[model samples]
Target: MALPEDMLHFVWKYRLYCTQGLHTDSGKSVVVLETGIHNHDAGPDFVAARIRIDGTEWVGNVEIHVNSSDWNKHGHQYDRAYNNVVLHVVYEHDGVITRQDGTVPETLELKSLIPVHVLSRYEELMRGLHWIPCERLIRTVPTLNRSQWLSRLLIERFEHRVTAIFDLLTRQRGNWEETCYIWLARSFGFKVNAQAFEQLARSLPQVVLGKYKGRAMAIEALFFGQAGMLENVVFNDTYPRELQREYRYLRKLHGLSPMDVSAWKYMRTRPGNFPTLRIAQFAALCLRSTRLFSAIIDTEAVNALKNWFEDLPIASYWYEHYRFDGVARPHSVQLGKRSIDMLLINTIAGILFAYGKYIGNETYIYRAITLLENLKAEDNAIIRRFSALGVQAGQAAESQALLQMKTYYCDKRKCLDCGMGLQLIKKQ
Candidate 1:
């Protein structure tokens, strides 16, 4: 917020600088022919700009700063890319500035040119405290503007997910399948026992799972054993004892250590969301899925893919019990539409988006967004609060974007960088 250079960039981009009275530090009149397209990439701030300084048309680049000396502070004086700069724009002309070739570029001091009200409004937006800095004014922003900003937010969230998945991929030595399995397991656990599920997934290697994936019973044993849920339990049921026996054999064969059962939290959690059942469901999915990531990528429609997962059979034991000795769930233990949507949104669709980014394919990205757009908006505190503010999400796409905006932008008081803040600040 303290960087007047950002405000200067905005001013220069929009020609908000006082056109009627503009001059360089050397008392030469100035006129901007075109601000040029702002360079969002590394090189210059603005490229191919047409500016007239002292009756000379210089078509090149533009660089801005709070003071003239920042050209050297940022090592732009040593960079060849700055050699073509036509004008050095600054808020205060503290010192004379030069290009890499040692020629002084024409300097435009923006301090007296920008409207005071604009800067004041920007400062106020940056300093405010509320659910969001612009909560009071956000609803007033034009719909088209909000739509464009939400698209950017969605892309931001996509990039964040892609980066994280890449990190997981790297940790597994560039194994995409293992990363997908681990990520899927974490998503299956949701917010309650995500870490424990992830630990279980990591502890059991893909090779061992591949060896037993054809058998649902063995898959369940591997998952439950690594989760540390089958330790020292004397069960009267034949199936539970079979799982304990299978786990004992697999634990010895794989040379694997079980995770602490204490790590799996069940306090106040729903019976349907119990770790025991979730692992069983997860094992079922792994048993049926071959090339799970590719299948998700190739699957075009949401419901078709959803039905594929819904077809996974919940083991009979899960139907009879929520835990090793728990009472039976009266209802079938099949994953509901809500649970499926959560997995699709947080895992399957998310992986598609990440894979699309990794492979530089727009098809997968389009599929991911379409799936999200078709789903119901997630019913959560964030989505509800956004709805109360008159910024309702029509689908999961907007809700996901809103969640990102609230977490990474609003909560951090980054209103100065938000579109809503920009719109309100520039309002007359």
Candidate 2:
């Protein structure tokens, strides 16, 4: 009997097929080493691997399937990438296949050996419900194992974020620090103002900011200039007007054109998080700290770095207003404790990966792992939902999965590919 589709993933995940020795349709013995379900973005669906084939030990990358016909279904015969596939292992036997090189690839069928209970359990997990799928089963899984799983998942999560960083670095011609600075500033603006901040960074340029380093006025000019907020508006408030004048002079000095303030949107934002205030807050940090990136890099103590960020606040003017002309508010636009903690985690993790790649500093890698473990998990809406499902996210791994679900699967509407979806389908 054909295995249920819900259990297919479990079978694939655990590589359960190899318990039976590898045998081709002709009954010739084929020595098996390992097998992996293809997980690449653009490739064949599965790989049946072996230690050796025809006297060549460690023959790599064999394609596999549930039946011989799926090879044609997935259109692998025409794709050259599948040419390296040495053996074809299927669950059902029916066809003869030849590679472009004229070597007839060996095929094996695996229909009888897989356990039924495994499939049933997977089906149970995948069943849809009024609330969360596998709600009861998640609680039965050991917390320690869950934590380890999350740790691995969180590292993978960071790698996903790093891919974007790599793209930014490439755009900046491989200046890691500059790219880091721009990304930090963009993140500070959050999703609402990210594009504006990016435009600001591109307009003013980090090199210009370096020239005005340690001076809040120069920093503000660069920020406002790039934001396109320092146009010909005549404001009576001495600070706003003075900054505009300063930006005008600086724009001329740098031979730069004026930016369109229309590009810097502030609709629907709370005054506290308005782009103007956030930019000013970033400018203040740039002025207050020289060697900011270096300080983060050299700090062995996570608490010390956390304390530094906690103590810093926005400029006095920003403490009173969310916009250029908003009524004064009592609170300062400083980074929150939770936000600071996130920054520390991300920065430390990023530096750890960089140090590992550049200087072979495994210590930084270990430190990054330790810091993530010590920190409390972020409590966001998605995490809260997972908690309602009885999958409490108290550590990095669960949080990572939650984040991955939110960013990738949920946003992309690819629920079919998600573990949660698989669990729900199995439950049914």
Candidate 3:
């Protein structure tokens, strides 16, 4: 395994070098004045650093490496971005380097500067087979730091979701309603056939559904027909024939094409999660609300929206059968409470977060935060694993943070970059 350069960057960034005699490879008198701002984007590791070299102050960027030869290995010698680097900081000075303009900057090696304990802790973390390397040490981190890290993790997850929504919004020409429709349709698929459901939405845009708004039959016809459901089944019930006829007329009138019905997953699926019922339940929501997505985004108080999705009435035909010719289940097809929560967490929260971020409005973000905080924490494998290690998630917000932490940090074994890893390894 390669030694991560981030460790060297960290050491260089915090001025962890031995201060008794700090000088460049060229043997110049050097004194640290100020370390530059750490830059995450393109260009340098740190910018605007002020350093006194040979009793003269110089200001520019700072680059870091595990070995001086990495400077050439990374082609920084030819890159113009390195021209402004005032210093080349490395762990070992194996080779010499110069700027693109044929000038040499000062070099400081951390081979004698870095402490032993940090390296020991880092190696220990890399050897772990535990759920997380810091699982045993997580509880010792101060409550305030842990809380702040979790908050930051949750925001990271939220921002990731927002970026995805913005990509869809851009493809849809900034149409929020269509993006919401596509998002909700995918959520309704519940992760199994989400792609198929999204294709269904794109095949029949929300504007098509808008033309048939408040007309339950027309909505059903368009939704089912575009789903490739109405054309294949022969039903004894009057509703199917009516839908078939209506869809045939509208399909030709609007030049509509239905998706392949085989795209939906059915084997081993629960009765409640049948695609027919989900589509009907979603269509019912469309019929009930004049503008479903808009109504959700415009709401101010979280209380009014708590039970908003509970009582959606699926079409009567859905109650009798899960498929077109399948035997009746003898039970009503109504949306479940968990399904409502799924919508809130996946669709509503995602859309509101995106809208807030896109326009720089904090109100929608606040509403999204409140809604998630009110809900119970998710009970998946990741959450259960974190819970087993004595980290309790009291709300969806914390659960989201745990997921981000586990996926992004623990799995990657970037303990060197984590707060827990820092506190656990720091010499006291």
Candidate 4:
């Protein structure tokens, strides 16, 4: 019978030792340097580590798991990285694992030594809850310690995001400014219309806008034209006519083809979140700030950047019109404090990772992590759902892990490979 996974995680996480002598299936005595879950890129779930095989004590990492079969389940048996694995530890020994070089890796099974109470508590924690997981224990968890833990988790989370951004950078040939612009443009869609925004950016090159960067009218025309928002629009208004003229001038200046405005989608969005409004707001920010990317990178005072972002408002004409043909309604284009914070966090992470890659400064990477930890956890529906399950948002390592789970695993449905899920079944 399969044990509950959470219990397994708690046992692995806490490293509960069993009374049985640690030994490989070949009958060689194994000395364990660590009994906790082994960190592997891909392999068995866990490894029973040994310091020495025969008279020679091994001095490297080991992998572990709940079953010997997991080695094949995760395809570690065929991977060369597992060749250095000193010993394979599992909850049950059902099969053997061999390294790529044809050496049969030593194995150990750990079915005993874990206490029932520990598993019980872990299970209870995983079950449904009213307020916070371990609400009774929350007040007792030291504030300073909790804060430090949270900081660590937040930095880890930020590093995770930066890794993805770096991959995108690699794909884009390390054009940091262009990549940033793409991200900024995509983010403006606010989850509801990301693909559409990305399409708009791809259809209209940032190079075109760069040419007219000094003039706000020229910039606005470039934005509106590329967005396909200017098709068949006849307006007597001063701002509309001016934009129309500017668009025509830019098309002629760049020898650009007309965009397919019909490709844009606006079915599910409110007027405030329409692509046109977002693009206009983006244009306004670009107009007001000439050296936006440099300003972000060199900014020493976080508050200054916060102030600058907060002050940015959408163009005056956008406040009334979601589209050129739609009835006008008043709306402001200013970035919220939360939005600014996210941008700062992402920008800092990207710059730090980039700098680290260029200069070999691990300190920059650590500092980037520190900045993320200092901020509050991201607010979103998934986080709120977790929060409702007694997993209150706070400064704990677990909370940080929860946040990461919400952001990465839950959103992506990678639960089968998650640490949390592994822990959930360890006890049974």
Candidate 5:
């Protein structure tokens, strides 16, 4: 099998090849000092690398490739970014490379230096057809290393969420509360109707809902009306009929239009998880607090947050109805414990971390992690698969890390970038 250039990068990055008796392709003796920092941006592969060639010290950037000709093949020969390259490293030195400045940098080839076992292990992982690339070999990695990697992946997941939250905040004109409202509303839809709920929130801004403050019926009217659920539909129940009337008045007053009712999903969905019930539950959540973001920031205890969602005063009409046209057997309309935990995990924790980053407060970040630690691990296909492989997640934090690792690393075949894969590929 042909090796990817990334394998060469991995080998160089981790010093997997023999470092003794190194030399350039031109026969000049080479000595490694600092490998420098790996650059992920648009620049050299590695920056500020320090090395000595023929007893002379040089410090600059370093570029890696699978073949020496890749330099010219990638047009780096004409790009000024390669002009300051102090060394050119390749797995196979197939051709001579010249910089744009007409200078030939020293080149080092790793074909004869890298361990055969390392290549074998990498090939094995690359050929893996298991749940994860290194699933068969993951048990070889120490538990401590796996835990440490999970911790790192958890932070990575938080950072990824923070990036999204910050982008939303930018669009919301730095209004944290509005962003929180939009995100929380989306979370209410879970995975099935998240986009539709987000559109509803965007169509009817939080300020529109805020005016209704203490009035439950008005808030539900705004939420259900803006969702387009009340449009062109006759409700047999008095509550929805009243909501329809209330929404008509509010709609004209605010000059607001409703989203397409088709935006919501119902097929294969549980009656309890219906969008109508979620909308009603969200209205109740709104009634519990005037400001969503402030509530997230002020609430300290995990149980308190859970209780806040659990104790929401969902209207009696919703207790016996899942939709406007139909009534189901009476059931608790308030969000269940698992549902509340999911909300905390996806909505509250991410915003808390993002807010902490925005305000440079470590307390909120710590609090976010603490909240996840207190929640049960999410039961999902991904978590179950990892458990079958003996990689159990005891809390939401670890489950979230597993989710991130699966989506970003396992599914993408980024084994070279994963700590567990690295451990499995590197010989002891």
Candidate 6:
């Protein structure tokens, strides 16, 4: 059976192929020196490779293919970029590849050199249908290996999340505080109303709300009004009615347009997690902090950071009601520790890491990782599933990594690319 081209790259990268009497298709003795850096970008499979072809030290790129004909099929023969390719490594050498300048590159056939077990193992992983490709074999991998993989995954997750933050920052003209505010607002919506909350934030910039820094009522009015939650609703209660009046004045003054009220979701949502309650809590946060991003950066302790999101001094009306015009019923409007941790994991860490990368400060990046390490692991379906499979995440850091692994690697079945998958397949 034919194997994936990536398997050939993996075999070459790890030197899993046998080296006894290795020779190119043209009968030139091949001695492997450095395998070179694996290129993820365009141009070559591996770059800066140091290979001695029959006592001729050639230091250049190496291209891998399942069949040698793929080079011409991929049009690298016509491209001038492939002229620097020192060696063409392929599983099967069928056709001769010549560069545009009539210089035929040396080719190494890996079919016989690669161990049969390695190919079998890779095939098994590719064909297996399990929770993960190596679900049954995962326990064989050492805890140290798993931890190392998770650490890499954590960084991957952070980088992936930071890409979005950087894009938003660019749109915000590199305003970190504005980006933080918008990101935090999205996190407050949890998953259900995240887009809606982001829309509200984009509609009303943080600087506009910054004007009413210390005033809780004014901030709530602007948030609720811009969210379109306060429109076309008659309230028997005094607070929402007052919010409506305040928002009308603020809306006209700021010349702002409110998002459609339909954007906010309430069905199947808990009372505390309702968009109304979250908006109130978010407004309270705005009322409490002036420079939110700076506060996040300056705070050292995890508890101190948690305090920013916990027990926000929201309007008294929110404590009694989850929505506008609702009757008073005592409920905890305060964010639970878990909710606070979610915000820390999703919102705070990302912003910190993105800022670190933006300003080229490793301190914020270190601080971001440290914050996740200090927090407890989140209890979600993804974390729970990994825990059930004997991979327990002890901290938010590990959980975050596991979440990323599950989504990007496991779900996509990119087993050959995963560390755990690599380890499991390599095991005898």
Scored by lDDT, the top model is: 5
Instruction: Put the candidates in lDDT order, highest first.
Output: 5, 6, 1, 3, 2, 4
Question: On a 0 to 100 scale, what is the lDDT of residue 54 in model 2?
Answer: 46
Better of 4 and 6 by TM-score: 6
How big is the positional error of residue 83 in model 5, measured in Å on the Cα after superposition?
Answer: 4.1
Per-residue CA lDDT of model 1 for 161-236, tens digit only, reads 8888999999989878888889988998889999989999999877888887578778888888888888977888
Clash counts per candidate, in order, are 0, 19, 0, 27, 0, 0
How should the candidates be ordered by TM-score, best one leading? 5, 6, 3, 1, 2, 4
Query: Model 4: how large is the Cα RMSD against the reference?
Result: 5.7
lDDT of each: 0.84, 0.66, 0.81, 0.63, 0.89, 0.89
TM-score per model over all chains = 0.86, 0.78, 0.89, 0.71, 0.94, 0.94
**What does candidate 2's lDDT look like per residue over 1-428, in tens digits?**
46543234346545555465666787766666666555555664455455455456655566657667777778787888878777776767678876666667777666665556555554454455524445556555556655554565566776776677778878988876677676767776667878777667667666777788667777787677767777767676777877888888888899887568887667887766778877886787666664455666777776876766664545577777777766685885787777776776665566556545545777866776667666777787878877876677775545766677567654654434555544433332
Off by over 4 Å in 2: 1-63, 71-88, 94-108, 122-136, 395-398, 405-428
Compared with the true structure, what per-residue lDDT tens digits does model 3 show for residues 1-428?
23478876766666655665788888887787888998888888999999888889999988988889888888988999999998888888887888899998789877876677767666677787687988777877887877888888888889989888999999999888888888888988988878888988899877777888678899888988999988667877788789999999999999999998888888788887888888887788777764667888877565566556667756777777887767775886876666777678778887888898888999888878878888788878988888888788999888988888898999898876776676676644
Give the residue spans of candidate 1 off by over 4 A. 1-3, 36-48, 59-61, 67-85, 93-105, 173-175, 328-332
Residue-level lDDT tens digits of model 6 in 16-117: 888778899999999989898999889889999999999999899999999999998999988888899999999999988898677999999988887777
Error of 3 at 346 (Å): 1.4
| Model 4 Cα lDDT, one tens digit per residue, 112-167 | 55667555644454444623334333344444554454455555675676777677
- Candidate 5: list runs displaced more than 4 Å: 76-83, 100-103
Q: Return the lDDT, model 6, position 25.
A: 93
* Decoy 1 TM-score against native: 0.86
Candidate with the larger lDDT of 5 and 6: 5
